[model samples]
Target: MSAETASTRLAEIHSRIARAAQIADRRPDDVTLIAVSKTHDAESIQPLIDAGQRVFGENRVQEAAAKWPALKAATPDIRLHLVGQLQSNKAADAVALFDAIHSVDRLSLVAALAKAMAESGKRPDCFIQVNIGDEPQKGGVAVRELPALLAEARAAGLPIVGLMAVPPVGVDPAPYFALLAKLGREVGLTELSIGMSDDFEVAVTIGATHVRVGTALFGARA
Candidate 1:
């Protein structure tokens, strides 16, 4: 997309976010918009960056490692987030590359991340992923196991900012978003990494601190 198109698309999403925040009586600035750039190459992403999008999300550490170093070197203030299911082996690289990680789902990964952070001294914010719908294929700590995992994550010195979740596909996501919010409060967390291109408005009203929007900003991915 051209810079003008990117700017217009970004403005529309921001307007939607502001409207949603207003309904919830919350400040729109509190909601970070992570333009998910997964699978999009640097050439495709630069237009959005030119349009003043400073925060972007990517799914794989290798993809981010390939593209973002050059991007960030040019635009030092750009923030990159890893919004994908991460492997324990990639913890160190993820720690080195991402400003935040939104998929802390298991004890082993938590351990890996803690060790990586301690070794590297880069404490990127972490959001514990909750399998809100109990989907067998999803990568989130089960609801019943959340407290223990969260407590362990704290003990391991991971900077636990909040919780993240994706409701089952094709379902009303309000209840799931609200449940994630309640769970976060119960754990004394304030940040939430819920919502995406589809339901971010509802997620905002339900108290999402970060929204990962892709297609809305970049157009349908090829």
Candidate 2:
């Protein structure tokens, strides 16, 4: 998309977010819009950057490492967030590249992240991913295991910021969002990283602090 198109899209999404926040009695600034740039390359992402979008989310640490360094060098204010399942083996790279990790679901990953943070001296903000739908195929920690995981993360010195979840598809998401918000509060976490392209507005209404918007911001990926 052209720079103008990107800027227009961003403005539109921001307007929607602002309206949603207003309706929810929350400041628009309280909810961050992370343009998920996973499959998109740096060339395609630059227009969004030019449009003043500084926070982007990526799925893979390797892809982010390959794409962000030069983009970040040119635009020093950009923040990269890892919004996909994280492998224990990639912890070091993820720590070095991402400003926040939203898929910390297992104890092994937490331990790896802790060690990586210690070795690299870079502590990325963490979000405990809960498999809210209890989907066997997903990567988030089960609700039953959240307390222990939260304690483990804190004890390991990871900066546990909040919770993240992807509700089941083709269903009303308000309840899931509400559940995440409730879980976040119960765990003493304020940042609820719940929401995506389709449900982000609902997420904001239900108290999402971060929304990972992709297709809406950057048209359907090829």
Candidate 3:
């Protein structure tokens, strides 16, 4: 996409976000838009960066490692987030690369992150992803197991920031987003990392502090 197109798309999404925030009586700035640049290469991503998007999300550490170092070196304020399921063995790399991790869902990964943080002295904020829809293939801690996961994350000294969830596809997502928000509050987590391109406005109404928007901002991926 061209810089002008990217800028227009970014502005449109921001306008929608502002409208959503207003409807919910929340400040638009409270919601961070994480432009998920997972499969898109550097050439495709730089246009968005040029459009003044400072925060980006990637699904894999390897993909991020390949593209971000050069980008970050040029624009020092850029923040990268790991918004995909992470393996325990990649904890060190994730800690070193991402400013926030939004898919921490298991004890083993928690332990790995803790050790990596200790060794590297880098602690990225963490979000406990809950399988709110209880989907078998998704990478989130089941709803019943959330409290224990939160406790373990805290005990491990991980900076547990909030909860993240992806509602079941082809279903109304409002309930799942509301559930994730409720769960976040119950656990004393104020940050709700819910919503995406299609349903972020609804998520804002339900108190999402972070929206992972990919397609809307970057256009449909190839």
Candidate 4:
């Protein structure tokens, strides 16, 4: 897409977000729009950045590691987030690149992240991913198990910052989002990563600090 076209599209997307936020009875600024630019080439995002987007989300560490360095080398201030399931084996690279990791679910990953932090002399903010839906295949801890996980993460000085979740495939997400907020507050977590293209408005209304928007902003992935 041409720069002009991308610029126009970005404007439209932002306007839609503003309208959605308004309709949801929230300030537009209260929701941070994280353009999920995974599977998208750097050229596709350059225009969005030109259109004033600074934060982007990537699902895998390798993909992000590849794209972020070049993007940062060019833009110098773009913030990258690892917003998908992260494995412990990739913890070191994740620690090196992402400004935040939004999917810290397992105790092993937490321990790996802490060790990586100690090794690198750097610590990135983390969110506890909760399996609010309780799906066996899901990549988060069960909701009832959150407090112990948070306690362990905190004890390790892991900079446990907030909570993140994906509601079950066929459930209303509002209650889950609210539950995350309540649990987050109980643990002094100030950040909540929820919502996507379809339900971001509900997320904003329920106090989501970050919404991972992929197709809504960038169009569907091939």
Worst 10 residues of 3 by lDDT: 177-186
**C-alpha lDDT of candidate 4 relative to the true structure:** 0.86
Badly placed stretches (over 4 Å) of model 1 are none
Q: Estimate candidate 2's alpha-carbon lDDT, on a 0 to 1 scale.
A: 0.95
Model 4 residue 19 CA deviation (Å) reads 3.5
Per-candidate TM-score against the hidden true structure: 0.99, 0.99, 0.99, 0.93
Candidate 4 structure, TM-score to reference: 0.93
When summed lDDT is taken over every stretch of 10 residues in candidate 2, the lowest stretch is: 179-188
* Clash totals for all candidate models: 0, 0, 0, 0
lDDT of 3 by residue, 22-96 (tens): 999999999999999999999999999999999999999999999999999999999999999999999999999
> Against the unseen true structure, what C-alpha lDDT does each candidate score?
0.96, 0.95, 0.95, 0.86
Q: What are the per-residue Cα lDDT tens digits for candidate 2 across 178-209? A: 99888988889999998999989999999999
Candidate 2 clashing pairs?
none
Stretches > 4 Å off in candidate 3: none
Local accuracy of candidate 4 as per-residue lDDT tens digits, 26-145: 778877788899999888888888878898999999988877798888887888888999989999999999888999888899899999999998787888999987899989988888
**What shift in Å separates residue 162 of candidate 1 from its native position after superposition?**
0.5
lDDT ranking, high to low: 1, 3, 2, 4
- By lDDT, the better pick of 1 and 2 is 1
Q: What global local distance difference test value does model 1 have?
A: 0.96
